[model samples]
Target chain A: MTEAQTYSFFLGCVMPNRFPNLEASIRKVLPKLGVQLEDLEGASCCPAPGVIRSFDEPTWLALASRNLALAEMSGHDLITGCNGCYGTFKDALAVIHEHPDRLKEVKKVFKGMGLKFDGKVEAKHVIEVISELGPDYIRERVTRPIKGIKVGVHYGCHLLKPSKNRPWEQTQKHTFLDELVEATGAESAKYKDKNLCCGAGGGVRGSQVTVSVDIAKEKLDNLIEAGVDCIVDVCSFCHLQYEESQEQLNKELGEKKYQIPVLYYTQLLGLAMGLDPTELGLDKHVVNTQPLLDKIQD
Target chain B: MTDSISRETIDSKDIDPEFVDEIVKAGADRIRTCIQCGTCSSVCPSGRRTAFRTRELMRKALLGLKDEVLSSHDLWLCATCYTCLERCPRQIKVTDAIIIMRNMAVDHGFMLPEHRKASQKLLSTGHAVPIDDANREMRKDLGLEELPPTTHSNRKALDQVQEIMKRTGFKDLIEGEKMEGN
Candidate 1:
C-alpha cells in the first residue's frame, strides 16, 4: 500500500477540553488506513466558537490567523477534527483573500507575534479529507463494517454554512459525510433541522445556559423523532452538547426519553477500520454508544 | 412599560457623550464604519435563522442605549459562529458585542429563562447535564458488558474556566444560590 497521507492535526478547543476522544479516535484509526497525522507544534485554539467575536473582532481574527500561520510556517495544510475550526479557519482565509487592506492589518497583527501567513496553508475538516480520499478508498480500508447500525448525521452549522468559498467546495449537488458514513456500512440518515445549531455556539453554554440547552434539546428531539439509533457529529462541541444536553433534558422530563448515543465520525470510522472500541475512546463519550455497540457485531 | 427604543442614530454628541468613546474603547471601534452593510446579518447563522442582526446591535451599543442593546432577544439568538465577524468588511467584532451585552443583561437580571435553568444545572453538576446515569441504564438494558466511563474533573478545569471568566470581568455572572430568589 502507498504511504498514508500525512497531515498536521488541529484539535480545536472543544476537542482538547471536552472531547479528547475525538483526537484519540482519529489517532487510533488514521494510521491503520495509511493516513499519518502529524502534530503541529504549539497550536492553540482556533478560537472559533470559543472567543467572543464582536468586542475584539481583530483580536479574534488575529488569533485564528495565528493558527493558520502555524500550519503555513510548517508547510502543511491544517486539518481539524472540529467543524467550528474548519469554518473559522476558512472564514479567516476568505477575509484575507478577499480584502488586501484587511489582510495587511491582520498580517501586521501576526507580524508582531512573529508569524507570517502567505495563505499557502488551507484548512479542512476531517470529513472533507475523507471525501477527497473518496468512498472507494474508504470502503477498501474497512476491515469490519458497522452493519445493522443507523446513524443520524448532525453536520452542525459551521460545517455547512455561508455558501461562499466553503472550506471544501460544495456543488449544491453532493453530500460528502453521508456518502462516507455509508461507505463504512452504516446508514447515514437525516433529521429535521439537520443544519441547526447544537446550542453550543456563542460561548452560550458558559453564559446563556438555558438557551444553549434549549437549542441542544431541539437537535435531540429532531434526531430522536427521526428514529436513528445514534447521532454522529463532526464537531466536538456539537457532540458534547447533544450528548450532555440530551441527558439533562431527559432528567428534567423524568424518563429515559431519547437515549440515542452520540458518536464522533472518527469513532465510527475507527470501528469500521477494525480498531477496538477501547482504543477509539468509545468508553469516554458522554453519550452511551451501547446501543450502537450492540449492533456492531464484534 | 417602557417605550420601544428606536434604531435611529442621534447626533454622537447628543448621546451619552461618552457612549461612542466607551464602545470604541471596548474594542468595537469599527462600529462607525459599519455602513449599514448587511454583510454581517446576511452571513450570520442566527441572523439567517431569526433575523438576529449584529449590525443593529453594534449601532445600539455605539449609541450607548445599553438597556435596549442588552434586553433585545437578538443577542440571545447569536450562535457565535463568528461568520459575521469574519465577513464584516470593516472587521467589526459582532459576536463579542453580543457577549458583552449578555454579560450586561446578567448584571441587570434580564437573563431569559433559558440562561437561568441551564446555569442551575451546570452549577449543581459539573456537567451541564448528567449523562452518566443514562449510560449506566442504557448499557444495562442493552446487555452490554461494560459501560463507558465519564471523564473525571478535578475542579482544576472548572477553576481555570472561572479564573478566565473573572479576568474577563464576568466573575459574578452566575448569580450565587443565596441570591437566587432575591
Candidate 2:
C-alpha cells in the first residue's frame, strides 16, 4: 500500500563490467522487495578506495565527492552493491565532514564543473537497505523457502569496518547478515575467521593475484570444512575472488579440489522469492551452482 | 671457526625524522600513540601467509624509517579490512595510516605496475574496469541496457569525470613520470 523506497543505484565497476550477473541479480530482486532503483547517470567509478585512495587521498576524495554530488542532484541517497564502492563513498564523506579543509578542496574542484556537494546525500550498501527493511519483511515475500541449504556468509570487509561510521553496533561479530540469510530458510553456517578479508581489497588482487588467491584459499578452506552448500557474499569483488580463486586453485593444483558455488546475496534471496535462477544469473557463475539449486528444488 | 650469522641494523642517518609528522599530517593522527602492541599484526589475515607485519610497519613509520618503510612492498600487502582499526586499543586509525603511507610511497615513486594500469583505465574510461563488448552483449541478453546509463552511455558525464580528474591532478599522476617498480 505504501510507495516504494527509491534510491539512485551506484553501480561500481566490478559488478557491471566483470560480473554483470551480480548486476542482473540486484536489478531483478530489489524491485520485488518494494525498492525502486534509479540509475545515477554518467557516474564514474567509486574510484575504488583501495587503489585510488592509496595513490592520492585528495584525488580520491574529489572523485568520490563528484559521485556524491550526482546523487544529491537526484535528491536521493545512493546505494551500491559493492563493498569497495560503498567504502569509498562512506569513507570519503567521513573524511570530508571530519576535515572541513578537505571538503573545501573538494568544493573547489567542483566549482569549475558547476557541481556542489553539501554532504546532504549518503552512501549505503545494498545489504544495509535490505537489512534495514528487516528479515520479517523479506520473510513474508518468500514464495519458496530454501530450508535445506547451508550457506557460508562472507561479510566482506568495508561493509562493517571503521565502526564509527557504520550503522552496525559490533564489527567483529554481527548477525544482521546471518539473520537475513536465515530469512530465506537457509542456515547461515558458522565458519572459522568468518569476518576475514576476501584478500582482493586494497589493490592486492590486481597487484599480486597469487597472494590474493592464497588468502582466499584460507577462507574457502574454512567454508568447505563447515560443509556449506555455497558461499553467499554481499560484495561483487569478494564474489569474484571466491569464484575465481576456486577455479584458479583447481587449475594450479591440477585437481578439482574446490567447486563450491559463489552467490551474491540477492541471487540467493531471488531463489527464495521463486524467481527463475537463470534470470538471476546463477548460470553465469564460474563455480557450478546446480548443486545448491538442486538441493533447494528438492 | 667463523659465525654464520649476519645482522643488519638500521643506520641513524637513513631515518627521516619528519616522516611520522608527514603521515600524521596526511591524516593518521594516532600514529605516535602506538605502544609496540602487535594487535594489528596478530589480527592481520595477510600477515599469516605473507611477510607483511602491520605492527612492524607502523613501528618503522613511527621510528621515521622513511626509506625502509616507503620502499618496502610489504606496505601494499595490507588488505585494508580495518580489523586492526577496530581492535586497536589505542583507537588508532591503523588502516588509514597504512593507506596514507601508501600514498606517500606512491609520491616517492614506489607504485605497483598493476595499480598504474588501473589508474590509467580510470583516466581513459570513467570506470576503473570499463565495459567491454562481452559485458555489453551479456547485459543485453540479461534484459538490461547494453550500457547501464553510466559514463559509458553518457558522453557529457564522462567528460565531467575526466575534467574532475584533470583538476585533481589524478590525470597527471597517472600520465606523468614513470614510477619506480613495486
Candidate 3:
C-alpha cells in the first residue's frame, strides 16, 4: 500500500458557502481513500480566477500568493475541489514563476502580513490526488460498487487548461476522468461536447445569467440525449451551474425538461464506497438524486 | 442613420497603437503572433452562443483598437475555459489575452456591475460569495462547523485578506464611486 498523503484543503466560496454537501462528501470520502485534509484556516477565497483575475492582475496574484503562503506555512501542498480556485492558484503560481517582477510584487504584499512565501506550496485538484492512487486502488475500496449507473463526466476547464502548467497528458481529449468514473463501477456515458464549459466560469454566470444558463442548457441537452443517470464533475461552481441551470432551463421552457442530477466526483466515489447517501449530502442537491439512488438499489 | 454609419466604421481616434504592447506585457506574449487562423474562435464554446469571437478579439487587440475592445460587452462573454488557448496553433494564450484585456478594461473603469458587487463581497467577507444564514444552517445539518475555518469564521484571517486587498488597491478600485470614470 502506498503511504497516506496529507494536504491543506483550500475551500473556495461555492462549496462551503453554497453547497456544504460537496464539502461533506469530500470529508467523508478522502479519509477512506487514505488522504488527510487539513483546513488551511484563514485562507480567503482563491479570489476566484474568473472574477478577480479579470478585474485586477496584481491583486489576483497577491491574494493567491497569500493562500499559497498559508499552505506553505502548514508544510503541505494545497488542494482544492473547485476548478475555478484550482485555476487561480495554478495560474497565479505560473505567472509568479514566469515573471520575477510579479513574484516580487506579491512578496512585498506578504511582507506586511508577517507572511513569507517562497513559492514552495503547489496547488492541486482533488482529482489529481485520487488519480495518483490509481484506478486499481480505488476499485479495491468499493464496498457497494454502484453498478449499471451511467455518469456523464464534466471535466470543467481550469483542471486541465493553460496546458503548459497542468500535468495532464492531453488537454483536449483527456480520459483520466472517464477512467476514474469507470472505476466506481459506473459507466462513463459518452456525450456531445463533453469538454464544453458549464457556462459559469469567467464571471459570465454573474454578469450574464441568461447566456450562462443557455450554454449549460446546451450541454444538458447533450447529456440528456446520452441518457446519463447524472452529471459528475470536479468543480463546485460547475456543479452549481449544472444543477441550477437545469431548473432555470426548465422554468424558461415552461416544462420539466432538464432533470439530470449533478454530482461532485467525491460524492459519487463516496456512494460507491458504501457510505450513506445522506452523509454524502445527496439529499441536498437542487435536482433530486433519488433516481440515481433507485438505479443503484436496483 | 448617422449613428448606424458611425458604428460600422472604425475611427482612427479610437485606436491606441501602444495597446497591443500593454496586453503583451500583461502576459499574453504570443498574442502578436496570431495569424487569424480562426482556430481559437472555432474552438471557443462561448463564441458558439455569445459574440465572444476569440480570433476577432485578438485581431482587434493587435490592431490596437483599445476603446472598441475595452468597451465591448462581448469582452466579458468569454468563459475563460482556455479551450481557445489550448487549440491555438500559434501557441497564443488566447484566453489569457482576453483576461489581460479584461484587467485593462477594469482599469479603464469598464467593469460590469455584477463583478463590482462580487469584488465588494470579497473585500467585506474575504469571499466572493459570503456565507448566509441558510448556508450556516446547511453546514450545521451536515455535522460540519457553523462556519468552515476560512476568513468567514476567522476575523483575523478576514483582516489579513482585507489588508491584501487594501495594499493591492482592490478595495479602492471597486469601492470608487464611478466605474466608468465619467
By DockQ, the best candidate is 3
Candidate 3 displacement at residue A191 in angstroms: 1.1
TM-score-wise, the better of 1 and 3 is 3
Residue A263 CA displacement from its true place in model 3, Å: 0.9
lDDT score for residue A206 of model 1: 59
Residue pairs clashing in model 1 are A4-A34, A53-B96, A54-B93, A54-B94, A54-B95, A54-B96, A55-B96, A55-B97, A210-B114
State the DockQ of every prediction. Answer: 0.11, 0.76, 0.79
TM-score of each: 0.69, 0.96, 0.96
lDDT of 3 by residue, B1-182 (tens): 46564456566887898999998877789887889999988887778877678788889899999999999999999988888888888888888889889998898889988999899899999999989999899999999999989998899999889988898899888887657443
Model 3 captures what fraction of native contacts? 0.94
Which CAPRI quality tier does the interface of model 1 achieve? incorrect
Candidate 1 lDDT score at position B17: 51
User: Candidate 2 has which clashing residue pairs, if any?
Assistant: none
> Chain A TM-score per candidate?
0.92, 0.97, 0.97
Ten residues in a row with the worst lDDT in model 1 chain A?
Answer: A49-58
Worst ten in a row by lDDT for model 2 chain B: B173-182
DockQ of 2: 0.76
